[model samples]
Target: MSRRPYKPVMSKTWYLKQPSYRNYMIREMSSVFIGLWTLNLLIGLGKLIQGPATWSQWLALQAHPLMILFSAVTLALALYHSLTWFRAVPQVMRIQIGTSFVPAKLITNAHIGAMVGFSAIVLLATLWGV
Candidate 1:
């Protein structure tokens, strides 16, 4: 019996062929931005603890053009990640009530609504603080 040769044939761009795969990759990439933003926040918090001058410096850095661009990108990525997660809920979580199945759209809408409500509260608190 002859041994067959193993084929090395995995394509790096396979995800580009399908829209869903592309969306998944984009959503996954959002985590990197999220991590960067979280680190930025932690550093800001540390600065705040140090003194008002240090905190002001941190805030000044955020006003830089590059920082602004980074913040915009991160915000976009965060929104995409959130929306993708909401879209995925129906597939991962199933709701049932005594032999009746809940609608997927309803679950997704509820998640989005809650997010908006929480965000509104945060915005209001921030305005109140200012």
Candidate 2:
């Protein structure tokens, strides 16, 4: 009989065992969707560059229910990624103004406010075609 070397068994669901690990995994995985969305945007830009008809076709493709669902999911994941990263800024970096350190909640809230403001501006500009 041949003796086989002993190998440690690793469970596939090990990350799910801890909430922190699961959340970390989720935050990390969200980047994949973000990257996909970026690629999609780039492709759409390329289509626009090709011609107005090409861009219209691309827009029509995006109107499909499946693409709409994918976009929604990707948007949600991107939001999650942004929230987690912005919230972690205080913990990862110490910001001091004079003798007092800035609060993490304040920093996170400021970032969230900035994001909303910028998004609103972009939406309005896009709608106004400016």
| RMSD (Å) of each candidate, 1 decimal | 2.2, 3.8
lDDT for model 2: 0.92
Candidate 2 C-alpha error for residue 20, in Å: 1.3
The lDDT for every candidate, in the order shown, is 0.95, 0.92
Name the Cα RMSD for model 2: 3.8
Backbone N/Cα/C clashes per model: 0, 0
Report the Cα lDDT for residue 95, model 2. 88
- The residue-level lDDT of candidate 2 at 98 comes to 100
Q: What are the clashing pairs of model 2?
A: none
TM-scores, all models, native as reference: 0.89, 0.85
Off by over 4 Å in 2: 1-9
Q: Output the TM-score of candidate 2.
A: 0.85
